[model samples]
Target: MIDIVLLSLLVVIAIAIIRMKDLFAVVMLTGIYGLLSASFFVAMDAVDVAFTEAAVGAGISTLLMLVVITMTGRKEKSTRHKPLSALFVVMLTGGLLIYGTLDMPYFGSADAPIHKHTSPRYINDSMEEIGIPNIVTSVLASYRAFDTFGEVVVIFTAGIGVLTLLCVARSQKNDEEIDSINDSMHQQHLVIRIVAKMLIPFIFLFALYVQFHGDFGPGGGFQAGVIFASAIILYAMLFGLSTARKVINQTFVQVIAALGVLLYGSVGIVSLMNGGNFLDYNVLSSNPIAGQHLGILLIEWGVGCTVASVMVVIFFNFAGRRAFQQHKKQAQDKESSAC
Candidate 1:
């Protein structure tokens, strides 16, 4: 019943997002949709997935969209409705997707091929093989560590791509303008600043807990990294971007992001050096189980570092771009006034 209700809400939110022209409201609704989706994931007993959706989908994603809106403006440009054409494409796509699923086994069917072939092995032997209570972690960190490494590389590449495309050249004048803007925000929100300052520490602590506790609980590097990035985001929001940048040097953050991918790859290379398959943690130490534990721990750290740094880098670039644009506009206005 709860799942049904949540699904209904998700549908409604999706339609609402499609119809809405106010970009800010749409961003907010998108965040709400993410939260609802997270709730549904929880209902489906996928708590780890839920944690990620809540952090990335609802939290960091929303903040990033909001930052983007600062430059893009609040309202969407109106476009002529193409209802018939859009509807036709949507219907065709939906039909094909549904048709594709027609021959699949029923959801959670015990007789499914996956259950017979793959899941049983993981379910029955993963504890003994990987020696971790959380089968999900074992599968992710050990069984499919290469895939996870690829995912980290993808994220790292995306951060580099965004930086290349959107990064502005910083100057002394731009920095002053950014500082002034932050000062204005800082002075206006005394209570928020105090409350956020209090919460930021706890948030960081929780992120670290999630980072290290995934072996036993419903959290891991990806989720923890987002949560950590979110704290920095919150600090920037309350204290100002200039101050945040001062504390977290952009050059250092970029280096850390690269280091994370290197760290994950290094583990795989080391495994090969040990005469084991790439990312095969069994050979990292004399005791296979101990090696598995160490490898998982290291790779999870790599994931955490990369994810957190990329998120911060993206936010910093967006916020800095906004500041630069604002400064340019101000200069233009001053010239016009002088004329």
Candidate 2:
């Protein structure tokens, strides 16, 4: 019953997002949708997935969308042309998805291929093989380590792509103009600043707890990384981007992001050197179980580093561009006033 309610709310939110002309409200509604999805995941007993959806989807993605809407206008422009082709495409895709679902096995069917094949091994053998109580952690960190590595690489590539496209060269402006622009961008919400400063330490602590406790609990690197990034983003919002940049510069972020991928690859390479296949953690230590534990820890750390750095880098680039544009507009206004 709760799931049905949440799903209905999600549908309503989706429709509202589509119909809303205000981009800011649409972004807020999208966050609401993410929260609802996370709630649904929790109800389905997928707590790890819920954690990720809440942190990344509802938290970081919403913040990014807000930044984007600030750069572009808040109001979506009206268009006269009908989106007939787009509507047709959407309808066709929806129909195909519904058709595909017809052939799928019922949820939790005993005859399902997943239950018959790898699921039994992961459930029964994971503790003996990987020495991890959490089968999800064992599967993600050991059974599918290569796939996780590829995901990390994809995130790194995406961050690089965004930086390449949006990290434009700053216009040559005098110190006075730059300082004035920075001053203007600085937020003056004293209450927010106090609350954020108080919460930031606890947030970082929780992120660390999530990062290290994944083997026993429903949290892991991906979720932890987004939580950490959210703290930084909140700091940037309350304090100012310049101050945040001073704390962790863009150059350092880029280097850390690269290092994370290198660290994951290095673990695999080391495993290969130890007479094992790539990502085979059994060879990392004298005790195979110990080796497995070590490998999972290292890989999870690498994933967290890459994800956190990439998120911060993307945010910095967007904030920088916004500042530059605002400065240019202010300069133009000043010139017009002089004329």
Candidate 3:
């Protein structure tokens, strides 16, 4: 019953987002959509997925979208193009998806091939094989370790792509323009600042706990990274981008992001050097179980570093561009007034 209500809310939010002309409203609706989806995940007993959705979708992604809208303007331009083609494409895709589902096993069916085959092995043998009681962690960090490495690489590549598109080379600007932008960026709410200052340390401590506690529970590197990034983002919002940049500059972030991918790959290389296949954790130590633990820990740390740095770098680039555009607009206004 609750799942149905959440799904219905999600559908309504999606339609509202489509109909809304205000970009700000659309961004807010999107956050609402993420929250509803996270709730649905919770109803389905996927707490880890719900955690991710809440953090990335509802929190970080919404913040980024809001930042982008600041520069692009709050109102969407009217489109002259007809929607018939788009409607057709959506309907066609939906029909195909429904058709594909016709061949799938009934929900939670014991006879489902996935349940009959691979699920049993992971559930039955993960403890002895991977030395982790958490089946999901064991499968993701051990059995499917290569795929996780690929995911990290993909995230690293995405961060590089965002930088390529948004980051500008050093250009000369007058001190007045710099000062104007800096002055405008500072938040005036002392209460918010004080509260955030008190919370940031606890947020980081929780991130570390999630990173190291994944072997035994529902938290992991991805969640930890996003949580950590959120703390930095909050600081940037409350204090100023300049302050955040001073704490961890874009160049440093880029370096850390790349290093994370390299670190994960290096673990694989070490495994190979120790006479095991790539990403085989057994060779990391004489005790196979200990090696598995060590390998998962290192890889998870690499993942956390890459994800946190990439998110922060992306946020910085967006915020920086917005500031630049605002400053340019202000200068143009001043010149026109002088003329």
Per-residue CA lDDT of model 1 for 268-294, tens digit only, reads 999999999999999999999999999
**How far is 280's C-alpha from truth in model 2 (Å)?**
0.4
* Per-candidate TM-score against the hidden true structure: 0.96, 0.94, 0.94
lDDT of 2 by residue, 1-339 (tens): 898899999999988988999999999998999999999999988999999999988998999999999988899898899999999999999999999999999975789876787789899999999998878889999999999999999999999999998886654453346556556656457777888899999999999999999999998888888899889999887667776777887899899999989999999999999999999999999999999999999999999999999999999899888877877798899999999
Q: State which candidate, 1 or 2, has the greater TM-score.
A: 1
* Highest-lDDT candidate: 1
Q: Candidate 2: misplaced stretches above 4 Å?
A: 84-89, 170-187
Better of 1 and 3 by TM-score: 1
* Best model per TM-score: 1
State the lDDT of candidate 3 residue by residue for 14-90, as single tens digits: 89988999999999999989988998998988888898899999999999999988877899888999899999999
Report the Cα lDDT for residue 195, model 2: 84
The global Cα lDDT (0 to 1) of model 2 is 0.90
**After superposing candidate 3, which stretches have Cα over 4 Å from the reference?**
170-181, 184-187
CA lDDT of every candidate: 0.92, 0.90, 0.88
Give the number of colliding residue pairs in candidate 1. 0
Q: Candidate 1 or 2, higher lDDT? A: 1
